[model samples]
Target: MEQIPKIIEKVSPALVSVVLIKPNKEIQEENQEKDGFVELETGSGFFISDSGLIATNRHVVFEVAGDYWVFWNNKKYFAEVLLRDPDNDVAVLKIKNQGKTPFIKLADSTKLQLGESVVAIGNVLGGLQKTVSSGIISGLSREIMAKDESYNKVFELKNMIQTDAAINPGNSGGPLLNLRGEAIGICTATISDYENIGFAIPSLFVSMAVAEIGAKTKK
Candidate 1:
């Protein structure tokens, strides 16, 4: 296997931070409100195609109400949802006016074996950019119940890849890359109050969603 640093260097450009920004209302002179951006949430995403197509978890943008943006290479790009998988906790996005772009190749998740080394990369604590963690696949085909940010909705997530990597809420939608630097899963949830317990959605579903989106766009 190549050095982990080398793999990360090649994949960093394709990684993106997904966020929802709310305009702050600041009444300074009782008439004019200052233009300030308050970030609601900062999740993670990655490029999947040359047309600026990005793959991320649906819950990242689920409650944003269309005010989402992607940060890459020190620039922020407005992003629009192209597709959301109804059967899976996945979503695809399109960067407005963006053409060719860097991307990470999706790998087969079905072949992943327990104890295989992996890396997790994404926004940590909704602000720290590109936080990296390494661990082995702790479990697979895990079925767990998760709650949304509002804590009103409880949903079950199935077929998850459990890892020992240090992941948190902000790491949602980030990539779980194999040693080859190919994306094998998308980070979805982490159990707090517990050490090294995180879960990811396998890449099989994500790759299928991307292909389905591409096919729809060509039509």
Candidate 2:
């Protein structure tokens, strides 16, 4: 209805597509003749600050020193990792004065209810940019196991949102928005064994982490 246009208008500019170049660990091991090898990785993120602060999943910025880069609007910009908390799968990145930019406002996840209609925006399969998908909140406060035991704290995120929206591989770190276009969650993971099992990091944590990062950066 009228709400759809309103949300998209406010949120679209805040969404950004990110491409990362990570070193290929396997390639480096196999090709000992070369100093290093790298593989390209891409994902999506949303701007949370007008001064160039971005909120994205830790995995989205995955790299080993000198191997990461970011792209938006077809322009490549080098970025510095400001803060990363693998425990929550969250990271804050800074790019020197890319100029004033539109940003997304975070919603209060505590108010989210099951069955509420929501939208997801991300780059799917690293092919398209600013793709939009919609679905209802299928479940809340869900949990999934982690591949690495050390990351259990992050994998145990609470107040998560589940949706049937088609969240593909490159959708990680994108925003799971309410129909109002406010970010209710950060699209994080999915249960691939079944259909439509996408999960997101609730806005509550994203807000807390981003705030802490901002505070720490001041010192």
**In lDDT terms, which candidate is top?**
1
Q: List candidate 1 segments past 4 Å from native.
A: 25-37, 124-127
Per-candidate TM-score against the hidden true structure? 0.87, 0.82
Error of 1 at 83 (Å): 1.9
Give the CA lDDT, 0 to 100, for residue 116 in model 2.
Answer: 94
Candidate 1's residue-wise lDDT over 114-219, tens digit each?
A: 9999998875333567778889999999998887664467788889999998776556688899999999999888886889999999999988887887698799
lDDT of 2 by residue, 9-46 (tens): 77877766666554456555654334344435677888
Worst 10 residues of 2 by lDDT: 146-155
TM-score, prediction 2: 0.82
Whole-model Cα lDDT of every candidate shown, in order:
0.82, 0.73
- Residue-pair clashes per prediction, in order, are 0, 0
